[model samples]
Target: MTGNHWGYGKDDGPTIWHKNFPVAEGTRQSPIDIDPHQASHDPNLGPIVLNYDHCTSINISNNGHSVVVEFDDSDDRSVIQGGPLDNPYRLKQFHFHWGGKGCHGSEHTVEGQSYASELHLVHWNAVKYKSFGEAASSPDGLAVLGIFLDTGDDHRWLHMITDALYMVKFKSSVTDFKRFNPKCLLPSSLHYWTYPGSLTTPPLHESVTWIVLKEPITVSEKQLGKFRMLLFTGEEEDQRMRMENNFRPPQPLKGRKVRSSN
Candidate 1:
């Protein structure tokens, strides 16, 4: 089904996703609650290596669901390796999911506690797969780095994004956003939880090897408020629905093991 057909509404929410994408009912579904005490500590799991020093960040856009910042992945200039991956995965794009003010908007939870929002840095296994679309459906195709966002003082560089929200208030709107390396957005620590999970959005492909960070980044409440200003509908559409609470609730663990890095 098309993205427009599925949304965070009463009639089109996660509860009914199984009807459209059968994989929604899969055993390895994503956004699962992370219980730190239950997770196994693997000494073999090395620290994840991110080589984004010279990464080429392109433009940012609003895709009706969330605001996405695209990157140029033509070469191996921007790639992630080590940890749970056998080969380096090329960085594709990054996006955020959030809720209305004063509510949790994160897709995944820690000990059943949800953060204000979540950040997903999507990458594809360019070595094993030729294209991102091809990799997105395979078992070992993608790696998503999830970072939690909490309400606090304004982030130092987040204004570079929130300031540009006015340009892409409507769906499918995009603008130039050059040289913005996402490495600046990462938390101080790279210690994370790793697992095999599906895409939080539809098709709900079980192709992602999730690496969720333990620490959360702080962003002011005013910055998050800017996200709510985006409209889910096009400018021509008569109905205006503000975009908020765009995250999917955590799914069942289904006996999948969560590995932690040292």
Candidate 2:
């Protein structure tokens, strides 16, 4: 994490990430376009299970990349299992990638069609590794559940998050946010496409096992506008750059099998 300052700008964008983190060019890169018809349905893959009833949500912050809501992963109170996972992955945090007014911003797409935004619920293999940092570099270390967000009617619970956006409108800003359950963000269906992939961000470790939902949630344009109000630069910086289009484009599938659980 030293000597590497990567951002979604012209000078420090994705194309040159490999200069700092060689793994950015790894074979299992993520944010790939999923073709439902091409994905192989796996009867062996059971329904994914999520037990987040008593999840301990910590605080929310703007980390220059996206607005992140971190959770307490000291225990397995919030965990996702089944599907392609042999063991449960402990929920750590959730973040969003979005675009500026009326632009597509989702990291992953389907049939080459992009969405307005994308949400990534990141988790780590706590059972196998002692800590998230240790697991983050391993091949089977992380599991990120990605959900798409489209512009439409205002989402029921999304306002709960958007309303808090002002508290962290600048990079490195944080505020207390507790007792929030992410289950409210999920779509009705649990069907997903699972594959081996890497983190979309730098130190682009090829350690993530991605599970992308087939269905997308709806949010209003006004609601998404709140996110754009935030800035990539800190409050002290002279220039204020609007935070949008913070998503990496689709990478090469590289012969990876995308297994669908339907």
Candidate 1 per-residue lDDT, tens place, 56-117, comes to: 99999998889999999888999999999999999999999999868889999999999999
Among all candidates shown, the one with the greatest lDDT: 1
**Lowest summed-lDDT stretch of 10 residues in model 2?**
233-242
What tens digits encode model 2's per-residue C-alpha lDDT throughout 1-262?
3457999989899888888888788899988999999899999999899989995999999998999999999999999999999899999999999988899899999999999999999999999999999999999999999999999999999999999999998888999999899999999999999999999998888999999998899999999999998899886534348899899999999999999997
- Can you tell me which runs of candidate 2 are displaced by over 4 Å? 1-3, 236-240
Off by over 4 Å in 1: 1-4, 236-240
Cα error, residue 34 of model 1, in Å, equals: 0.1
Clashing residue pairs found in predicted model 1: none
